[model samples]
Target chain A: MPDTAPPAPSGLAGPPVNLRNPVLAGVLAFLIPGLGHWYQGRRFKAVLYAVCILGCFFGGLSIGHGQVVYFHWQNPENRTYAYLCQFWTGLPALPALWQAKYRDPAVFEDNRLDRELNAVLTATLRGVEGELRGSIQIPPGNPGFGRGFSAPFEGQLRTPSGSVPVKGQLSALMLDPQVGAGSRRRIRGYFDGAPTSDNSGPLVGPIEGSVPRPLWDWYGAPLADTDGSPNSQLNQAHRALGSRFELGVVYTMIAGLLNVLAIFDALYGPAYGDEEVGPLGPTPGPNPTPGSPPSPGTAPATSTPVSPGGSA
Target chain B: MFPATLLFPLLAAPVWAWAGPTRTWYAIPLIISISLVYSASRHEGPPLILRRALRLMLTIGGFMLALLLLLLLLSRGT
Candidate 1:
């Protein structure tokens, strides 16, 4: 008679593995916008990766927009919150996104030939050239040191330099967040000619600040100084967005990555099993024919059998 | 521009002979607030005497206050 001793169960070598419910790979990802894909074993898209790539590329922009508005209203200053808003605003506002993405400080260049040229061109259009002069009075308790002012046109008041005409009233300012007051200050000396405190009001002095020499000097001042040419002031606001573009691109890319990861997770992660191989592995099937009696040389199944002895 | 109130005609003339930025801003909000209150009162048809008078008073009062605030802003701004 052939020996019929049951083969030893290979507990360590269980059936081939395969996962289901791929969506649950990363619970946080689904819970959090782009985290589930990351949980399902995808990297790079743990945070921003999902938002930029997946959200933007996959018609998720509407979702991104709503999310952005919700988050922006919730936390206006947070970079993450700001990006959430910006991402919805889309590519035209890329510069804004770049800043929010990286939290970088924008530094305006010392010269803005483009703005100067534009102003010059526009002023010439209205017959007599228009000039704007203003001084800011920053209170002592404000964040920076002494306040400064901007000269009208800064010598570029004669020619058009850019595509857009320069309208002085609309020119932007490089506002110091710490100062609740004006950024520019006019030197209003005492009746004795001794410099007293700068007055807090609109442009009051002669248009002499339009000369190039003073304009150049004003622009040359440090980024924080209130003393700047009109071009510099506008450029400062632009720079604030300019320096941030690269950073925003990075963050958007990260969001995209997370979005992709989430997609992948939703498509592939497992539903059940601990210490089990990911769903991508091979799965096992019955031995071709069901209910066939075990052969004399057949091995017992590796999985522990459910005991009939547990409380009924 | 429609029916000029006592203060409206004076406020509108300097900048446009019809309006000022500060005054306009104030007027818009006040008008909106009046319309809102009128709707909120849940009346079926036109407002009665007391309601109509109250609406006009709120409209005028709110507009004046908003104008005052706007003037203050302009005085202190560029």
Candidate 2:
């Protein structure tokens, strides 16, 4: 062989390996967005990745008011696909898993109220108009009952004069689970146990013996009963971000998804010119030129050299 | 001690408080971040990265705007 023999051809060859452990770099990036690039000694790129990915993630948290990022599988209706993309951003974004595990304290609180209000209002409305009319009844000694009704009462119920009954039905319907949090909370005051002392009379207690135990359970349970209020710090931070909650969610998800690309870069360096290796190694060669082979008795130039620099 | 009543206003404020009619504007920062990060990944040089990022951002924004216009026209036609 000549003094300058060509290097051995290895299948796993490309750009110079920059990191002590590319796998570690990829893992670091997966865990902390830009950490892999930082591990690879690409400080500027690392900082850029961190800022872009984290900025988007936290911005989304702020926009969505922290309520936007959560994972749930139990309720098909509540399953948020955004978390799928947001999870890629790594650690700072992991609170969503915690939020999901804890059942979103804010959402749980809202759901508790929903279950309560749904039961009570369903019973009340059914008493007034539905098939349960003349059937639903509240029990004596119930906290909700006024002292006067010791006996099981029944028949068409009436609210205090000048207070409309239909309005309560409308308000109750707004608390139904299908409604969004914003719209549901808007009507919370109307049915939140306070005397609707305005146009909707004091909620006439359900008919004695007619109201279901489920409805009363809602009225009696304490506020802290549902999963205790969400992480206060998270709640506070998200609240501060205010109306941009959905936007914050998008930023965070994009950040996470972007980190996925960063992880790939860490594992496989920058994709410069490794295109020669086809799915099945280097492609055959350029097509034969117009008339014939370059030499009268030799084969056409079908297989070109694979690597850029030819052998010495 | 801070009176709990003061906390009510802060806590009770709606999720959509500041986001009300102009929520769409939030896309600007997100797009800029995406452009910067993506371009930075391709080039090690800062100046070239930023220049390419800006170009990508403009291209993306223009495409989005065109899509929006097309959607608006379609809706009006319906």
Candidate 3:
């Protein structure tokens, strides 16, 4: 390529000036908010952008307990629109892609398991109660007390005659036949029909529709598997945060959208004209000629101030 | 000095503490941030930017409040 450098100034000269490369600055800004401004030596603006934008983003992450950031395209119904704004925060938002790809499928699978468990629990309780009332004497040591059963069963049951072999893995306590409660009420309470004094002992009480751990894991928790059950450290953090999850998501999304402005500023100096004179100084006010003294008494030609935020 | 365990939980505290009826206050900081950034991008001098940002914040806050009130009335069908 030919050396196409412009000829040196022919007259008295001033200090040498450095020009900003908009493309490089814009790319840097996109990679990290405010980096482009820092590249252009706008240190103040760079710091401002970095602090405000990143603070909002990280603040949101802490609020959501890291659950608000995932993306889900496979199941469009599950996709959170907040991510659309969050994607503008550049690299910080990329983990959402990893979360969507690896984590969401497992959550969906757990949801399926929860639905199946719910059905089995409901059916098993219905069958047991119906058969017990209908005079079907389950043999003394039958595997399912003479009822054909498929689901895994655990826990003991006591009847009027003797200990009935009541087997079901859903509840952690034995069903007391002498409690004289309706079968529907027992099923609602998941067979923890009566309160036992020993807290360390099995949870045999009329809990207010408390679903099993696996079912609660599916219906209530967003990051149930990663948190390792409801009582795990991560879930405890989530419970503590409560309803502020939405606020966290908003903070992150606002941070990302704000970065879009920084990116634009880096690409094309400020939306308004630069404060300092540059190689291509503020678009030559109304008069085109450079260095020409204004003619006597004509008002100085003023440059048009750009609109708020230099939106264009 | 705070305990080490307290520090982490404090840092990780949700945006709003005891966020019941006062939950609406959470939007104030966000609106201020939005105003500051928007106004800063449009002006050069620090004084000018700060002044514009404050004005913008008030304008946006008032608009949101008006909208909220309008919605509340509409919801009541009054």
How close is chain B to the truth by TM-score, in each candidate? 0.36, 0.65, 0.63
Stretches of candidate 1 off by over 4 Å are A1-155, A158-312, B1-78
Cα lDDT of model 3 by residue, A134-248, tens digit = 1111112212332221223333343454434343223322221111111121222233222132233232322222222332222112332333577642355457677777788
TM-scores for all candidates? 0.21, 0.47, 0.48
Please give the CA lDDT of all the candidate structures: 0.31, 0.48, 0.49
Model 1 over residues A1-312: C-alpha lDDT tens digits? 122322221111232222123435434443454444344333432333343334432222222221121111212232334344334322323433332233222222222221222222111222223432222222222112333223233222322332322222222222222211112221221110111233322322222222222322221122232334544432343354453333333334444343333343334321111122224431222332233232211122313232333211
Q: Sorted on TM-score, highest at the top, how do the candidates line up? A: 3, 2, 1
Candidates, DockQ: 0.01, 0.19, 0.19
Interface RMSD of 3: 5.7
Candidate 3 residue spans exceeding 4 A from truth: A1-19, A102-243, A274-312, B1-21, B67-78
Docking quality band of candidate 1, CAPRI definitions? incorrect
Tell me the TM-score of model 3: 0.48
Please provide, for model 2 over A205-259, each residue's C-alpha lDDT reduced to its tens digit, 9 standing for 90 to 100: 2322222332222211111212224633234334555556556667777887888
Give the clashing residue pairs of candidate 3, or none.
A153-A167, A153-A168, A154-A168
